[model samples]
Target chain A: MTADQTAAWAEQAIAEAAHEPGSAHPSREEQVLLRIERARRRRPKVREERITLAHGAGGKATRTLIDAVFVDAFRNPALEPLGDGAVLDVNGGRLVFTTDSYVVSPLFFPGGDIGDLAVNGTVNDLAVCGARPLYLSAGFILEEGFPVADLRRITASMAAAAAHAGVTIVTGDTKVVQRGRGDGCYVTTSGVGVLEREITLGEPMVRPGDAVIVSGPIGEHGITIMIARGELDIEADLASDTAALHDIVATLLDAVPVRMLRDATRGGVATVLNEVAQAAQVSVVIEEPAIPVRPVVTGACELLGLDPLYVACEGRFVAVVDGDHADAAVAALRGHPLGEGAAVVGVVEADPAGLVLLKTAFGGTRIVDVLVGDPLPRIC
Target chain B: MLASQIRELCEPGRQYTFMEVCGGHTHTIYKHGLEDYLPEAVTLVHGPGCPVCVIPMGRVDDAIDLARRPGVIMTSFGDMMRVPGGQGSFLDAKAAGADIRMVYSPLDALKIARMNPDRTVVFMAIGFETTAPSTAMTVLRAAAEGLSNFFVFCNHVTIIPAIKAILDSPDQRLDGFIGPGHVSTVIGCRPYEFIAREYGKPLVCAGFEPLDILQSIHMLLRQLADGRADVENQYTRVVPWDGNRTALDVISRVMEVRPFFEWRGLGFISQSALRMREAYAAYDAEVLFDVPGVRVADPKACQCGEVLKGVLKPWECKVFGTACTPETPIGTCMVSSEGACAAYYNFGRFTRSRHKETSRT
Candidate 1:
């Protein structure tokens, strides 16, 4: 049918829904059609029909688009409050399952590649949910003209990352698209983990007096990837901080009463903190001096006019613990190999709830807002 | 110096308005929350320094037109992708099957041209002096290498003319100017002397760091307190008085100042923009392609023109938070993150509301 015919049919259905055999006493078919019409009207109309790069920017636009389409279509209690993953109760045991797709350009970077990033990303999602990641599923979509050597390197990296994280890739699938359809390859991974302890970790557990601790320095992974593209023409020893964080989480759990655990992924630490603040209805005040950022990362961010706080980190996670146990938490995190740079960066506050603020070294506080679109490189 | 010390320096009874004429400075001020420590009398007015934000809709439409060609590869700094044209944006065009790519530098566009021999690579060269020199160098390199496929859609603007336009405006009441550090690095402290000599507004060239901005503000206030209205350099490490002579020479050789150029918010200003010199006309995308050089007006509801002149604050605009948000921006000020409106909406709206409440009381 033509576009006009389809529209006419839809209009007829809606009209029938409005006027039935008996206007006062409608039939069951009429009631069903009326419900359908209401649902159709309630559906959101996105301004743009096609997806743009901003949809993946991990910002306000991304959230709106996700809520309008995916959340609306797959409406359920489990997925209602979007976190890193869904915590499902299987046979009276808590299980956390999460999935992420890796479509980063310049597949290979100084520290990691699409393969390792895919593995670490999924593992971190499950690990941050106060769970012990167990297994992962790898699915790849490769372009027809993609090199086999690159594919092998990515798969090997994934395997190495999985092994380091103590997780197995139980099942896998691969498909090849037409030459121009895909950018080399895209990897989508699903991770499953078991909740080892009875601790209930999330926004509910987050309190006003909680202390925020970061695993390491910020902006490494993002800057490394940008530099790897060979666009900036600046050389730095900076590399992606892509690592497995299950061990660090486990160690920190034993040392302190952790309230909330979150892996700073796509939107970086800023997004994660903003999510926590909004979800818990508490303000997060971070000290700029207390935050650890490598000089190289700072230089790169300075050149491009990008902020380190809003950049992505693959390996890092933020742990919020009760103020009483703040020191213990930092010590525990620092003792771990992945958390050597761990520091008490911020504190949860009562006022200005649902906002993240940074206490600048200049004795001023700035709002550490969520990432809005990609960090566009600028010369000035 | 601490921001608190600077805050103490701000005269409480009188409102001291300081305009930062660089987008990077605007970003730093908002991102670092430097405005929070300021006394109620001090206000930091964001200026028209964001190149991505000020590229009029007509230029973007022309870019999209050039991008839509069969074997054309349109390259630009990533910030320009989301900026709306008359129809939509470069992102929208890319989604609709345009070979648009984001580059960190003009050299990257040159590289793409080198890699794709058969494709015509067009770099949407935008920004102030900081970026113009690189574009000029790229053109010179293209010529040296005999790369006929490379072209530059030169939208590179001169900051001094734009600054002069702001200073000359009737409503411009800025006490001092926080000069753009990077732009000054290319065309140094010498050009900004006009502001102090002619308008008696102190211009302090500043770095992008939080501390750098705070110090610059402090320096400006010192000048205000001592009654010295002259151009000062706070970003002495990067920008010298004479500027980068080599880069300026390259820019002068390959490009020429346009007689008149239309700014999105500031309207038409003479010598406000740059174009390829006759010697490099063969590498100019505007002459080679059939782009409709149309003059599209800003949206009627948008108060960006007033905002650019520091006449109206970003939040004071009618459509600021409601219609003109970062997600769906209707005006040039809301397009790029570096834009004044976008910066306020993204990172400073909460503080802005608090300031509003304090001012009301």
Candidate 2:
């Protein structure tokens, strides 16, 4: 068939397939055409009229929302991929810019509050982009009824976290919303960091045979927040893993070769792995036994039917490193207090590119897809 | 036994089809990739135990209506927040300025009612017997506390009647059953004895763990290989043979089985649902709100009825992915996480690409 004929035929088949049932018998060309057409049609759309909680689930729905609305409206080379941070080129050097909003219910959680989260979250975002921790701008939206004492506590936390991360709070803004119009407080932080080192790393650098290493145990931050919200009514000695990762990242970079690094923040390590796999066109196969999870977090996740991999990790990150240097990288990370529980969790593969699979502890393999909606506690 | 050993014990030449009757089991099977442990000769079918999926659309519309009412706060489990109604989901209602809140448990709704004495709190009670007792206890507490504004829109379903209907259906081909662990914890294995005695099908009450599921599958395989059929408790740690008597008593006192209830895709099944008893009528949201009890027909393109009955696979439905999906579901089966279609779409899509995978209709 001619190119025009093929395109017309493909378009017709796709339109018909949307309205009609599958054909029992078709030509080989027609089958291929239908498969490709279906794949294109299944791409997520951000056409909803209003924002629902699903839009903020940090899952497929969230990705669709961001892509269709924000990314479509603000199309730029820096803002195209929608990574945690935008890597920008400026006069023979690179800078990483990223912003995140914290509106977690129960702003105060074990081990950290929204203030601690805001500082560490943005710093880690830029730190993962292979940037030197530099500066942050904090914006606070406070409710009319919010207590000044609470604000003082949060600001203190932010100051402590910034000082620990060696980043300056260069500028900030505060606004007060009407009563009942907001949660107690919401903090948004924008981070700017410069790339000083010659070493290069990113999702595109990941390749087949690269090793996947997690900085520490996963799911602590998510579970702690969930418990703090008084939803499950379960008790365990669990605390959020909210800490800066620049020190650990630097240590790993200096000791062994690294490909990509991402702090498992909103959507957890599973999401980071999926992004890396898709960017590099490689498959990520993670060993369930090798993934580090605290016992209490595991117990809570089991009760709530939440996957530890999908749970948020404020201080944890997944690093893709050269296979030969994985051991050394893990050793270097483990030497740091924040990365004490570092482990080699998975490896990239050539087959089934752009997919993440888990080798279960029971010796069976399953796809580790991105999180769907927010994980809810199931009765069973 | 390990999943590998369970696989080895399966009969090699013949196909054995076992149906998992709980959404939790379906979720576990998909989440832990337990399906990979099943031998090629065995096929597992998902059943309609998902309370959220079986909640008819008209009821959801009523919930949205009630949520939008002045001085009324409609509460529901987080799972029910995203389920689509004729207009939209509870989440959409909330987005549109409705007082719809997601409560972790029914007791939380009662507490909200107590705190906000001026507002009426309507809890959308959902789930099987596993969750029914909690709602019942909450209602009892509300009654004792004289909380007149606290109400329950009961949609609690009983599992056995639905299971019996599936067995009586013309398309019934299930060789065995993997019963819900949580429901069995409440009603016990006694409720499932009829399947073994009358239908001659083995029923294994299983837990929601990957290892527990593998063990249950092994038990079912043993029953098939030895030509024996009986109710076996694989989750002995939690579920006793007679079940929790205290919970059953509380349920019996506060609620009664409805003579007929409309299951979303399975049609009307007798004694398959629960409603607040007459003594607790004051606490019933349906009566307080004058709910129409309207029946909404399933979408024409949705084959969830056949899928629930195991007569058709999810992918076999004409609109499985094209018109029906988790993002914009046309069918209830696609909305709930535990629903068979959602499970397949989320965890089993890869199975469709593997030529060796077997799914019998």
Candidate 3:
């Protein structure tokens, strides 16, 4: 079909999708949110209108908030689709499904936002499962009395991000809530795609002596998001490294029988490695020098009495695959723009299931365990 | 230079005992895995250095009571969050949405007061000289900024008084001291001279590096063999014969010596703690947050008091690995990575334990 016909057909399907879920979808409420004229006209009420945490509850109050604000703006082809789930067709006989919720304090942040986080987070989740992301479903929980301008900006970013990920937003949902009852806006997205042809995935298949690979430097996502929010006055120009990882994951999967993949989020590499070791019943030995970390993040961590090892990550992943396929996986990942700095970080061992040992450059070993407390509280 | 000295002086077979009286030193020792380098005979005993470790369970329960009061925005450093009170901790209250804030510095507590104009912000003021400067600065700054809502619950302790208390204890078996360099930098070397003269124990203010720790052990050994007791300065780079005058002056003015303070392991030591100077009552968290509860004693089987006084090793406490670890610390010696027992266990205490268990099985 021609591009125009394809666009028209997709638009029609989106309209039908939006009709059934007309009032509940986030994009619709966001469009109404962007109506600054109406918001300004009701200035006296706007002053009384402030977000409480309850707006994120997903109820009638949530609907009114999104309708009065966010849904008014950010109306787009993909977001307007309002589908139950974004249907993605892949080249192989497999399907991958993933979902995430973004409730970052500042709906927008440096390098990304709740929209960017929702899209990238969903895409990365599918990618780690060895499936290229095909399409995404975005649902927003907007606080009532939230500004229309912010809603438009966030949706626009999400739409741009979906295009970058080569995925179409086929469907979605929206809701609103009272001002004081919510903390601005929250976004949840789900993505589904097919695994590459004949590639098996999961941790149970991981064998000893297989190599582990990391996507780019660690802790940047955590440090960047922290600095962007102006929480700690860490004197460094850092931004969150939140981005889609499907492109790199696909490249690596194409060249290897990927045994397992997991994005290091919340608990950082320590948690990620520990999870892999326990799930696969294997030990992991990683070298400290091999794990890349930006100097500013390292310095900030040192100055603020924090550990770089236990820090959080929103845009990195740990991959375990066959030993013979290791070089090929590294090559494929390195070739991608997203995985330019990817490197072989560690190797699986036959002993000590559920343990992560980091060999320092000084010839010492330290256990990398899952962090118990929040690395940087209020971080995305 | 100190490392080579350690190599030359560290001979095997004779048991040597050393104690460090700073939580900072304890944390540094374990965090860097320094204990692993020491000879098997060289036992590094835990001192009553940790403020949270020694802050009696009653005080913790008291803090919890204050933390839950309405309009109270309680703030503290990350360390105090998980420390169990008689019933619960500040984190337990925080999880229940009691507005307990975990701040990096006392200044952050002051800043919280500046931001939360409507509520009373109480900084859970705990720590030694290393942490007290910031707390004092918070009080000074809050008063300067005219923030009426800001207060502090002063559980501040002094290193010298605690050192003296430990030395005076009947079970004191330490050969020498790995004198705390950070505290010495703040309070100066002169204060620790008493540890040498009065206790007749060799005292060496050591730095936090692995090499520095190894050398301190050597210094303690030489003093023991020579039957000499004196204060020495191995960390002369930072520590002076006298400490930071401005800080001492400020702390003295804002606070005064408490007659006696309750400690978890050490009980009450006269003048061991510092209290707000009456003038700063409006900013004292303990007073504003008045919650009373039972003075639950330490577990009967736990040897934490002996462990703190160097009379018993951490592993000797029956609860070292099985019931007490960093995960579920039954005593103060297990919670901090720097606690003498925690240091031994975290790095490789399990190796010995596993070996013993396998043999028994």
Candidate 4:
């Protein structure tokens, strides 16, 4: 479905939820999302310090509100399909399986929520692993007092998103928690996909001559999440690069023989690169200017004392491909819709062991290492 | 820039050494890769800046004792949770069901005391002057509020006397100094004048900024090249000559410098530690405990002392990555992120071996 069709489907789902039988019933996750959204607002008009069950109820009101606002804003085909699961048909036998949990604080954010996150997170997880995601299963942990209406709206989005992904969510389970025992909702999803026949992905496969490539910009997802949470009072034009990148990967695989593929997740590019270097026992060099970084993300990171390289990413991925195929790989990626701004950011070299080096913009070098303590907690 | 100056200073075919007393300062330099920018003749020695590195086994044992006591809620900075005491680290106690809390600041400990009135809250106050003010403020406020269950095990130490300890030692041979950015912000450049006059060593009060450090290095090198040693201030933006008077006043009024204290690596240093005043005696965790002795004992097969003293490089220590790492730290230096060995292990060690091998051949 196109954008308009998804928008229309989202409206119908919202309308159905609002006037459905056993309306005003929301699941724990929906209620939690609403409360976090309310709490994260600039001028919170608090009538009472304590939360009530009405917030979680997915009745006509809950359905109408979420559909009219959240679903309406993040309108997409899979999200609009509003089915129970996403289904896909793969032509290849190779597959990648991955999962991710979305427990971000203030579950609702500027550009996305747990619903969109559920689809994008699992899809990206598989995409980074060199898989063309084929299916997804979402699990929800709800609180007892959550509203049915809110539940309908959230589930509606989950269904529509699964449909849009061209994948099937064949199975799911929902558990309820006692009021005050849970924050709102927690989403754990598993994704399985068939890999491209020509691709092989792993750290050990990253030989000395392979190149590391990144699609689009870095730090947008992390910065967008930070801005959504109001952690650093900063604004940016960046949105969460929270989308499935299987199509982009397929395009790259069509031209280049990938040695290894991995997503920059919790530890960002630095962590992912370090892991690759250690596993392959190869020295890695990342050019500062080659890797794409949005000015907004860079400015906000500079203001908040965060390193863009270490920030998390949901949509982007790093590819280690054969040296001779580097240009062909770049061209393949550039031809795809998701790989327009792709670039070869670094290369693998023979190192003694457990070494990752980052050559700075100023013609100097620094070690890009993992964060010692918990990094920006509550960040997805 | 100091990098340029260091390059020029070595033109006379001489070597210059600089020691940074503050651990935070040392981390800033390493984090920014400023160390490599310095010319070969210039060496920035890691000093005793990490409180976790300097904390004796006895105090850690004291903290563990408080943690293990029934109905006692012990709080500490995250770094202190992992440093092993003679008995066990706070993490070991926590894993074994002790009520141990990790707090960002002492204020969090105050809130913990307020929330859990049924349990006694013992805060392990550890750090140099950079963190002493906050701990002192908490103790003062607890006394004022008459919070009966709130207490502090004072392990606060000053930087000047510790630096003086190094300078006064018979084997002292440093050419110049890159004074701690954070500690100097608290103690100011005034107190360091005595070191310059008595020791005749150039002192550059550098900030943690890469440019500030590089600039301070330039200043120190210029002084050394002229055969003139004096105290200089490079981080004047946040710090002042007089320092934070309010914080210093509170510290002076409510605490006394320990007559003689046993630092972990530097051994016994005069007037290096702080103890609570009589007015706040009720909130002193040390007084509350009846531990027999505060003895000095080194960890088995550890080179933390030499590493902390600037006499040994982290790589020179036998157990750098072999027996002691951040994962299983045998010494305090291996545990704390700011500790010399840890910084070297985390960011530079893998490359260090590579650089060494390439140079040797």
Per-residue alpha-carbon lDDT of candidate 4 for residues B252-346, written as tens digits (9 for 90 to 100): 87788889777887888888899988877888887887644545366445678888878777766644544454544667887776788877765
Ranking by TM-score: 2, 1, 3, 4
**What overall lDDT, based on C-alpha atoms, would model 3 receive against the true structure?**
0.68
Question: Which ten residues in a row are the worst by lDDT in model 2 chain B?
Answer: B352-361
Cα RMSD for candidates in order:
8.5, 5.9, 16.3, 17.1
Encode model 2's per-residue lDDT on A1-380: one tens digit a residue: 11111112223323444654454333443353344336434546754578987789788778888778888789898897667798888998889899999998898988999999999999999898889879999999999999999999999999999999999999999999999899999999999999888867788888888999999999899989989988566788988999999888989888988888889987888888888877787889888899999999898887776789899999999999999999999999989999899999998988667778777775556677776567755555
Specify the CAPRI tier of model 1. Answer: incorrect
For model 2, how does the per-residue alpha-carbon lDDT over B1-361 read when each residue is reduced to its tens digit? 4767777777668888889899988887876677766777778888988989888777787788888889999988878977877667787789899998878889888888998999999999999999999999999999899888999999999999999999999987999999889998999999999999999999999998888888888999899888999999999999999999999999999999999888888988999999999999999988888675545556665688888888777777766655566776767888777999888776665543542232210
**For every candidate, how close is chain A to the native chain A in TM-score?**
0.87, 0.90, 0.73, 0.71
Indicate the worst ten consecutive residues by lDDT in candidate 3 chain B.
Answer: B352-361
lDDT of 4: 0.70
Best by TM-score: 2
Q: How far is B125's C-alpha from truth in model 2 (Å)?
A: 1.1
Residue pairs in clash, model 2: none
- Show model 3 residue runs off by greater than 4 Å: A1-92, A324-331, A376-380, B1-8, B225-227, B287-294, B301-303, B310-316, B320-361
Candidate 3 on B9-41: residue-level lDDT in tens? 656566677888766676556555454355457
**After superposition on all CA atoms, how large is the RMSD of candidate 4?**
17.1
Native contacts, share recovered per candidate: 0.34, 0.24, 0.00, 0.07
For each of the candidates, give the backbone clash count.
0, 0, 48, 43
Worst 10 residues of 3 chain A by lDDT: A1-10
Query: Which of candidates 1 and 3 reaches a greater lDDT?
Result: 1
Give per-residue CA lDDT, model 1, range B304-352, as digits (tens): 8889888888866655554455656777788777899888766775565
- Model 4 stretches astray by more than 4 angstroms: A1-92, A99-118, A139-157, A174-187, A216-242, A251-257, A288-308, A322-344, A361-363, A370-380, B11-13, B70-72, B114-120, B140-149, B287-296, B350-361
Docking class of 4: incorrect
